[model samples]
Target: MRHLIPLLFLAACASTQDPPRGPSLPDTCGAGDYSYLVGQPARALERVLIMEELRIIRPQTMVTMDYRAGRINFKISDQDIITDVTCG
Candidate 1:
């Protein structure tokens, strides 16, 4: 009986689908779509809406070399402005 309870709990926690979040992200990152954000203040990104992962890179910030598909990268210049948008 104890095993049955644990098995049931596992089943309830198993999920193979996107949560209630609106839509699934694309297979590849789309940097161009966010090009408009360039020249904007980095703080603006905090209020930006997105479904994919966002990585904010500031000047001299050490980041991982590993690239992940569908991940958006925002590079901030020393002036705190968004200098570039790339998909990693």
Candidate 2:
């Protein structure tokens, strides 16, 4: 009976432990069907912020971040190609 009581207590403590969690992403942003945008001319896209490596100008109706989504964002290449498309 003594051993059983300790075992029950251990089981209860384990049950109260939180479950493991995985990495999470914002609900506002996600990888959508931007495949069609690939290979298309960058100019063909509607008004959106063009993201490149290291050049800056006045902010327009677009912005960039390591992770963000809520609007159309374009990841472009130096050659002016639409490399990736994401939605926030």
Candidate 3:
């Protein structure tokens, strides 16, 4: 039908304007430590107890940083890549 073409185009344009999708970020009370061994716990750990009180904690994701053609690059996925040179 003729109406289908315009509907498809509108849907395609609408999707492009949305922000990146993934797991939403949790609230942080304040800055804390996120290191290992006998010294102190991570900043995230300070807000709540681990393994005993709260069980909803998830591991922090590892990001890969790189440099490509004079630009700094951070890649989260095959489709998710960011490049910046202003801070460099």
Candidate 4:
């Protein structure tokens, strides 16, 4: 009985599965359409994903890119204006 209990425990542990993941991000982030956001009020955007600098990225909310293909970052001014638009 003792051996069977340990074997069952081991089997249970080995059979456990990892939690399911959420939806995946798109291959292309589609940053080009946001050029109009530059020089506009920051609040004008319904979804403002702000980034202070390119080096500082939020993994849960952001992705790092080797080229300017699939990411758009907005630099907001203290006065709540969008000062810059960049792609990564």
Candidate achieving the largest lDDT: 1
Predicted structure 4: clash tally: 0
Query: What value does the lDDT take at residue 52 in candidate 2?
Result: 31
CA lDDT scores, all candidates in order = 0.86, 0.55, 0.31, 0.58
TM-score of each: 0.64, 0.38, 0.25, 0.39
* True-vs-predicted CA distance for residue 6, candidate 2, Å: 51
Q: How accurate is candidate 1 locally (lDDT)?
A: 0.86
lDDT of prediction 2: 0.55
Off by over 4 Å in 4: 1-29, 47-68
For candidate 2, which ten residues in a row score worst on lDDT? Answer: 52-61
Candidate 2 lDDT for residue 63: 57
lDDT of 3 by residue, 1-88 (tens): 9989999988887755668698733324211222221122323234543332111112354433431232221112232222111110
lDDT value, residue 82 of candidate 3: 22
Residues 35-86, model 2: lDDT tens digits: 5767766775665434432222122435545543555556676677777665
Error of 4 at 25 (Å): 22
Query: Where is model 1 more than 4 Å wrong at Cα?
Result: 1-27
For candidate 4, write residues 40-80 as lDDT tens digits. 77776667554322322322445545765445666677667
